[model samples]
Target: MSNGEMEERIIDHLRRNGKDTALKICKALAVSRSVANKHLYDLEKSKRVKKNDGTPPIWDLMETPDDPRPVLKTDTVEKVSEIVRTGGKTGLKAHEIARDHGLTRKTVNKHLHSLMDKGEVLKTDSNQWTSTGHQDSQASGDVTVSDSVLSKCFDIIGKLGKGAYGCVYKAQHKYDGKMYAVKKVKLTGDADAEVKALAKLEHTNIVRYITCWPSSQDWESCQDTSDQSDSSIVFKGSYTETSDYDSPGMESLSISTESESPAKPSQKHRKESVDPSNPSTTYLFIQMEFCERGTLTTWIRNEKKEQRTIIEIDQIFHEIVSGVEYIHSQNLIHRDLKPDNILFGAEGKVKIGDFGLAATLTNPNGAAIYRTKGRGTRSYMSPEQELHSNYGAKTDIFPLGLIWFEMLWELSTVSEKAYLWPDLRIQKCPEGFCVKYPTEHKFIIMMLSPTPHVRPCATTIKENLDRFFSMNHMLCQKTI
Candidate 1:
């Protein structure tokens, strides 16, 4: 084909698939990568397409014209009909149908109107078109197990746990048969942040992200709705506050010491007034690698019970720091850092899981930036974060300090944690433990410094641990 024809085909492909990398485009079009790149750059220069700075540059049409030209083909009508039918109850917007087939909005509307005349589809008040079928109606009763989006793709094993906003389900992929953790939460302004953060990260210490999709809230009833007991969900570890503690400089800090149990689901759905025209709230289902060993809280309890050595505890803490280092290297801050958010993966490797409050450092150099305060869990949150202050990567460091303390000491009871949590913040360690691991305690104090600037970065913390372990190993060898 001519150069002009090749560019046109590239534009058409982008319109149909939204975006693609040069390599994929070349393979799809049966053209050489060099040939595709040459034309793609030309179209980019002409402002007909745009390229994203990913590993393999992603190319997509910059924008379509106000009056798009109709895509000509012998079976255009059949294609449009198929897209509508597949859209099901959720339906498709004029633009969605148009872009899906590489056709113009006007062309898709013409086909939609024709289908309406034939009673093949109907447009809802929401301005979305859906097929005229009983199963595809808004008033259709509880979604059947076969028709539910969750059940269609996954074999629902059971509930994993509940979060502040939604519930996590343990499921097995119908095709792959591999287990996965799926989080289902109502769609909100910040609903996609976790997915975006997880998508950008891939590390041994970080949870593996699979994929995500949007589904109507109807999937709830299709799940294990019959079971309303607490046993239905995974039991999460608990935390208690250090009440009645007053320090000279720490009086201004508002640290919550109340018990924080995991959020639970309602036993039954509340019956409420229904607006037939109103649409159901959409929920986002994010699939991730399931960690059977559970959270760091469970791991810590087990280790304490087993009476593990300080050396073994250092290994776990090192792994956690390594994950934080990797996250910081990626220019991301996992604002909500705590034992509950950390998990043990398949081979019992530590993995950071929740990214609900993660923020990307817009600064290319990964410097501290101003952010809204009062985001993370109050107990594990840093003082700088508790105050209305400019924060950055250091916000994450404060929680790491608290986590390290949790690992080293055995505050197994609520009363013990309540009495010790405040003192630990002031770097007042118990007599024996402090003398034994003086270096570790000093580093922990630095990490928990009130001033964000005083706190060491994750990289520095990792290096300190590396040096300490190296020196300790050398001393042991000399004695032997």
Candidate 2:
């Protein structure tokens, strides 16, 4: 086929598939891999497509000749203005801006970087840029969080993390004299579902909801009325039935109930409590215990600490499984469990956070509910999850295996040196280097088994690890 014909076919493939890897296009179009890639590059250069920089490049079509080119000049200026206006506080990455504005990622990145070079935008972090040099008033204008809003809380601290929903901040409660991690989620469709799912959970190993606060600001600063209706729907559910409020949002008050305290209310009563009815505003303030040690990912990546030993691994894994088992018992599936969501508390207690994608396995009538989104990190997701097939508790097991492997190996499986046990066994080993532990290795293998049904249940996994630890103790005694 001619180069033009090959390019057309490649574009068509990306359009049909939404996203297609070069290998897939090559195989489907009967073209060489290199030829397919060259065509993809040309298509991307022509601004007719884009590629997702994952493990493999997944090409996506941008626009066809007949399609109207989206007007991004207005969005670009508005986003920059928001950044400049927010005193560099509310900046979003190019990709995020692109997704929000329905524009091409390439176009967004190009304009954003240009703005950065011109001193109109400042790079806040990798891929995150904000506006600088302007005073708080010049940047925010009337859109600023009112002093009344600020006074209601003790002090708003720095950001903890960002997600699809909203940014989480570490804040101090002056009246209570307590530190709380406050998750400020923008009211959106799925956000309400997340709040409902979280309300059902009362595990010590999970993060507590202090409260939820809703905002009346436009979803994005674009002032585009078309998307405003969609935004209101997303934020409305969290504030229904509150008669005292006269705003569009509400704050949910949450406190960590994990501590053994007679001062705290019982979990049963807390679950049944409801806010007063209101129409103008609905907000929730979720009060959760602050995890000082940060996320498990941060802990693992920080080179300052000594490598985690086998015992530490056992302890951490036990905590994780116990928490997961509790979540399972509550009939909820944490669809997005990962190292980033696992956190360590003041006393080194491990707890699972970020339940935005969690789902209740059973409905109000106790019938099973199946989730369709298949939400999770790709590398840690089970094959069933990756394929968007039916999943259950077994889905969590896959990430458990990957986490264990990383803890033991001190490297990700995606690394070149991370090989299967069988392959490693065939090679000669130096002295003092121990072979992969039979029980632990077997456990990982079982968890990573291709079939979800064959994967060990959470209880079975916990029991197996307990037995393994017991056996290790016996072996140590013999050596002594």
Candidate 3:
């Protein structure tokens, strides 16, 4: 086939499928990869197609006008619908879709920006776009969760614990017969924002998302009916300033009193409470395999009483490194890599649980993205991470060292010995409590090399663990 014919076919493919990869285009068109790319460039230059989002730049076809010489509509609503349907809820850029469609990238990008300006398509994260209408609709249902979705998999049994995000419930899937810890985040503040961020990640060490349910009108109606039934009982008492009274307004008054009181409010306020009505907006529901052993913080504290052996410490360290390695492999920097975020699953399998502050290494749209402020636990943050400077995988190593130090020293010598260490004069570990390993001192130095460059990479640490384990095995054989 001629070059023009091949290009036309490519455009057709992209238009029909919504998106296409370079390899798929090349194979289907029976053209060389370079040749296919050149055709795509030409088409994109002509505004025939565009990329889906800032993500990997997958290509899609631009909708054409029916008139022989039609003027472009460039309506934001049309662009958003195209993005949502083609982008599969995970919106891509127009340029990316165009490239896949064998169209000029420049032309596609122009339309994308136009749509963004119209507020039809919103830029999510670095370069991704999603329908603004969709996001708004999702946000509106901030209270009620869907029973249809919830009923399929699991039934919540009891409360496990609570944290800054929401309550943890022990739930069991009816069909799979699997037990999972379901975290319900109420849609208040930036709960939905956090959930969107969390949804981007797909890693073994990270917690998995089951689904989200936005509050619906049906749920609101049910709640209203239920409230009316209880209203009579709730308001059947005389009022007094000091004494508790039953009144419809009494509950509201009590809420105000609690807010004004000198005494601290209930732990519910202090901790994160997931909103019930709008699971998607008010709360984010994340379901993952239950870790019966609890968090690394609790485990380490309890192990101190048991007087854990060096072998136990080594094993824990190894597991921690493995989980970190997985995170790095996915090009994700888990800024909050502390004992609190680490959990022990069945058979003491360590997994990283949170990604609220995690940052992707590369922009999904192939653009440079920057965050100004530092995030994650302050005590464990690397110097560069704390400064909010450009960072890579090495950014995570500093905290790994601190966790290792905590594991080795436990509660006893950690505080006193940490204070005795010489100041490193480094900006990252300013307290100078960080130390190198295998030193001659009775107290091993904490691994707090303030300089990110000096810190060991995840791969290097993994290799060291392998060597250590190998040597330990050899020693055991000799002793036997």
Lowest summed lDDT over 10 consecutive residues: which window, candidate 2?
233-242
Query: Which ten contiguous residues of candidate 3 have the minimum total lDDT?
Result: 247-256
- lDDT over C-alpha atoms for residue 40 of model 2: 87
Which stretches of candidate 1 lie above 4 Å from their native place? 1-147, 221-233, 239-279, 363-369, 474-480
Candidate 1's displacement at residue 3, Å, is: 56
lDDT of each: 0.68, 0.56, 0.53
Provide TM-scores for the models: 0.59, 0.53, 0.52
All candidates in order of TM-score, best leading: 1, 2, 3
Over 1-480, each residue of candidate 1 has an lDDT whose tens digit, in order, gives: 677668766765565445789997887677999999999999888777888888887887774455455664645676777788898778987767777767765467667765654346777745678886522432353422223456577766556555445667766687887878887764443455677888999999998898887655435422343444423344554423312211001111011112234223332432222224445445567888888767777766667634866567778899999999999889888877888788887787988877766777765664444444565677778886665435678889988999998888777777887788787776677667678678888888899888889999999999989999778777767877
TM-score of 1: 0.59
* Model 3, position 30: C-alpha lDDT score: 67
lDDT of 3: 0.53
Candidate 2 has a TM-score of 0.53
Q: After superposition, how far is residue 353 of candidate 2 from its true place, in Å?
A: 0.6
Q: Which regions of candidate 2 fall more than 4 Å away from where they truly are? A: 1-151, 217-285, 303-306, 365-368, 412-434, 473-480
Candidate 2, residue 127: lDDT: 38
